[model samples]
Target: MKQTQLCTLVKKSEPIKGVFDFTVEAPAIAAEAEAGQFLHILCGRGVFLRRPISICDVQDKLVRFVFEVKGEGTRELSEFSVGDKIDIIGPLGHGFYVDNEKYKHPAVIGGGIGIFPLLKLSQKLYEPLVVLGFRSADRVMMEEEFRAVSAKTLVATDDGSYGYDGYAIELLGKELMESECDVIYCCGPTPLLKAVQSLAAEKNIDCQLSLEQRMGCGIGACLVCTCKTTHEGMDENMRVCKNGPVFDAREVIL
Candidate 1:
């Protein structure tokens, strides 16, 4: 069940250059939200389409989401101040599977804004290793937050501006070569996700991927957010909002 609520904005901050973090007072959504789930937010009047933002954290009666201002809708959301009421419908979408006890030493990897959903998953895992990638130092966000929840955290940048001087997947590949992990969990751009998926397969490691897609309705009724799936011996298109924003690496066509 989904509820539409006018949530009070509690805190808004730009942790990095263009990204905005919003914490809102929405006990129902927070209480029910799972890691990798997202909220459909009404930015403001005249913005016909609600923006889908992934849940970054859930604490007590508050839910936090981090997003980069990519257009007028997000720019309007960024302008909202504390005490403002933001209309939201959530916690929507199928989330990451965190209870598979088969995965012991899991590696959580994310890129750019994709790191947002992994935060809550990190909090639930038992000291999983975290790896994050950014285009440069100025684009990096959530290092300390991931560090707080992870046993170890690694950061990589495309340029040599911060941390390792390459893609985070390089670091992840090196880690896999050095040691063994039960599984790999990831969310990122299509290129990054593809690379991670390939690497995981090369190493014979179990992996799960969270996909990002343009969505019309946050629920499956719209049928806009679909991905190719082959999980149940059926090769078909699955709704990301209903079937998953997360899918097994082996089952998804990527």
Candidate 2:
């Protein structure tokens, strides 16, 4: 566990009202943290527990986290200013693994806040196709970033206020069947995950998924983020904060 200062803040979106991007100075964690690892951050003084957020990006001396201020803790985080010091412990959970050869032409599917984590993965994909979903045009984000990294980028809005007029999976599903993509990765709502799982099954395609769960310990110790999987066996409870925030698509029940 390590404690650090909230070095800076970058406001990346006006789309989702309370979302903000935080850039913290955590050289040690950044040195060891991989693309899919997450951080457990405490945004305020005397907060009982920290919030587990995915590590958005990691570089030489900094780690980034893109978060939505959905509740009290995050709301508190939103108020923090530059040079404010906060308690943080992490590079906590497991992350998505990239197999450039096997995933030559890969596709990333993200929904709402879920899109945040996928951005890091895009940096590693050789030629990626990113499909992001939002409720409306006002909610859409990261289009330019995806355009910058991915070979092809598509955006979909539930209400047709942005890119395509449909759900992300619907658009991605159609595109997956028609494209020469070798693998798929996704992070989204439960229903969307189910749909992606079903489609991947039908195609016998390899897919990886990142899960979001309420957590206590951002490490494996508390087992707070336990999830079912069929990977190594039929009855196994995997810890999301440890074993993965990322998993093989077919292995996860959802």
Candidate 3:
């Protein structure tokens, strides 16, 4: 629970009009942060609860996060300048559990804001075939970053202004059909997750999911971000902040 400075706020795209990319400063957190871990953030002083954001890209001495300015807290976060600092507590929650040998030629699927966490994961997991879905061409983010790490990348837009003129799932199916991947991992809206889950189950491919749940405490103490899952033999409710923001696709009911 360390307080840090808001170092850089750069707009990545005019995508979705007001969304911005904030490359923040938190060396201590960055040093220890993992691929699927997230940072708990508080934009203004009076906001009692902090917002949980997935870690984006972390370089030496700095950790970055890309967020859409959906509300006042994020809007306020967008207003910070290079040197301005904010109170940030992270890297919270359990990260993605990726198999080193089994995940060779893994395919990653991300839609809209869900792409945030995968960006960091891609940096570590080299050359994954990535599929990103956006509302339009302008709303798209982080194409270049994917190119740096991914062996193959595909983009889909609702209005057909991008790489593929359809949903991300379309591209995902295509990627799966065209290539033989060892495993699959995905993050996005509930519908997209459901679709991916179904696909993974049908295909008999190992899959992992990162869940986005509302939180009171970024850690497990408050039981706010609970999800249903079957661990060993019984069904149980687990807190996302502590037990996992990441889980095996088969373990979760979804």
Best candidate, TM-score-wise? 1
* lDDT per residue as tens, model 3, 1-254: 44544444432333456866667667778788998888888877656788888888888878878788777778777677666676788888889776666677888899889998998888777468888888898888888888788998889998899889988988898778879877777888888888888888889988889998888988788898899999986899999888888888888876
1-254: candidate 2 lDDT, tens digit per residue: 44554444433333457778778787777787777677888867646778888888877788888888888888887777767665778777778889897678888999988888888899998989999999999888779988998999999999998889989999998897689877888898888888888888888888888999999877778888899999776868899988899999888986
TM-score for all models, in order of appearance: 0.97, 0.93, 0.92
Model 1: colliding residue pairs: none
Lowest summed lDDT across 10 adjacent residues in model 2 is found at 5-14
lDDT of 3: 0.81
- Candidate-wise lDDT, in order: 0.92, 0.82, 0.81
Ranking of models by TM-score: 1, 2, 3
> Candidate 1 on 1-254: residue-level lDDT in tens?
68799999999999887799999999999889999899999999869989899999999999999999999899999999999999999999889888647777999999998999999999998789999999999998889999999989999999969999999999998888887688899999998899999998887888889999998888899898889989788999999888889998988997
Off by over 4 Å in 1: none
Clashing pairs in 2: 36-95
Worst 10 residues of 3 by lDDT: 6-15
**Whose TM-score is higher: candidate 2's or candidate 3's?**
2
Candidate 1 Cα RMSD (Å): 1.0
